[model samples]
Target: MFLSRCPLSHTRSGTAGSEAPATGETSLGDSLGTFRRQQDILTPAELAGMSVDIVGAGALGGAILLCLCKMGFGITNTLTVTDFDRCEAHNLPTQWFRPSDVLMDQAKVDALAEMVGWVCDRPITTACDRFRGDESRRLGPVVILAVDSLRERQLIWNNLRNREDVQLLVDARMGAEVLEIHCLDPRPSRRGTTRPAGPGTREFYEESLARPDEAFQEPCTHRGILYTTLGAAALVGSILRAHAREEDYPRHLVFDFRNFILLAHGEGHGETQF
Candidate 1:
């Protein structure tokens, strides 16, 4: 039997089985380097013309911002981030931040946005203010509600609900070792008269910002765990990719890292182990 020809034989450099490229010519690998170095499975055009707006820069929000950046979100899409918080020593444990950024007179969004721009070669806009009220505005069509409290989430959601400009919403909530991710399109339910339209003559849903203590904010130590956020950020990245592909994504996902359990909602809810 005759030996087969080597695949590398076709590579340029005017020599058989050579990987090097000739001067003035780019190699195939060089051409696809950008594509292959991507941290996401989604295509480069994945957010395309649409921009992203993230409302928080804490554990969950910070993780999501960095995750999307790694996935080439910064390169392909304009990213608008908003937060009224600052980076402190305690935040270094759970959020994507550096120690030197602690006292730079920079807001959380300003610091991270700068880092992301430098690292990703894409400049992202920053708003060092809180999002509030009905009839408010959004920086982009897609919004990520990564705020700390339920009341904050409700406020932003209710405000964004009426905006024809706001089309997609990704809500992320983390509790100890578990996190809930919900992707909402905010489309009016088409099944009218299918049953008596449930409560609220008109409804724009948001989570209850209720916490056990008299204090609403999470204790500094209880912000989040490193492990839980890694998994949650990866999952939310998947959600963004699914949106890019126009695939049917989970309306709600609750992942419990404590027991390795996963709860996903379809038309209804179901649970399973990862």
Candidate 2:
């Protein structure tokens, strides 16, 4: 028995052999592959633009704005910041403000945008008022609530939750030694509803600017420049990643700078130790 010769030897036999391109059309297959390859190389315009509105211009917000602007994302993806407070003398070192910026009405939006324009050639927009009332409703979809008080955080959610456009809500707080970053991604079914508090926590839908012994203007802790910016910048980078993907992360990242360890807390309900 000759054993039917080698199957690979006959290119045109047995229904055009399995080695040939599907349907005997290498050109079509090559074209389809090339199309997919080209699709993967999408431009900035093709990607969903990022419009980040940061509330507060203290250590966290200032650092986050500086880092994001320096990254040179784009002009169209505007950064609109809101802060009714000005930079204080003590915040000079850790915060991004300089001596010249003192008493000069360093509105968070204007000052940060000016810096972005000078350095990144990207101009950030401004809304010098507080991130509440009818004016704040203009800024939707992405909100970085970096305020100092729980009251302010609650107020931010009240405004953001009612809106349909806002998808990502990031709340980052840094004490003297610990830093916590909370992220709430919109749900598919109730994407427009107000954000419900995490499993055991109370719903802070009406965050006012009042909490005696811990006033909105009161500074909770004296964080060094290293940890403040380090933690806030990291959180901003994480939010940007989530924004770029338009998805939710698996856990909340808590950075304990004093211990030099990063802890990720699971969703649903759980505690994590660094």
* Top candidate when judged by TM-score against the true structure: 1
Among all candidates shown, the one with the greatest lDDT: 1
Model 2, 175: alpha-carbon shift in Å?
0.9
Question: lDDT of model 2 at residue 247?
Answer: 48
Window of ten residues with lowest summed lDDT in model 1 = 4-13
Model 2 clashing residue pairs (backbone): 141-166, 155-207
Clashes of each: 1, 2
- All candidates: TM-score: 0.74, 0.67
Candidate 2 has a TM-score of 0.67
Q: Model 1 Cα displacement at 71 (Å)?
A: 1.2
Q: For every candidate structure, what is the RMSD over all alpha carbons to the true structure, in angstroms?
A: 14.3, 20.3
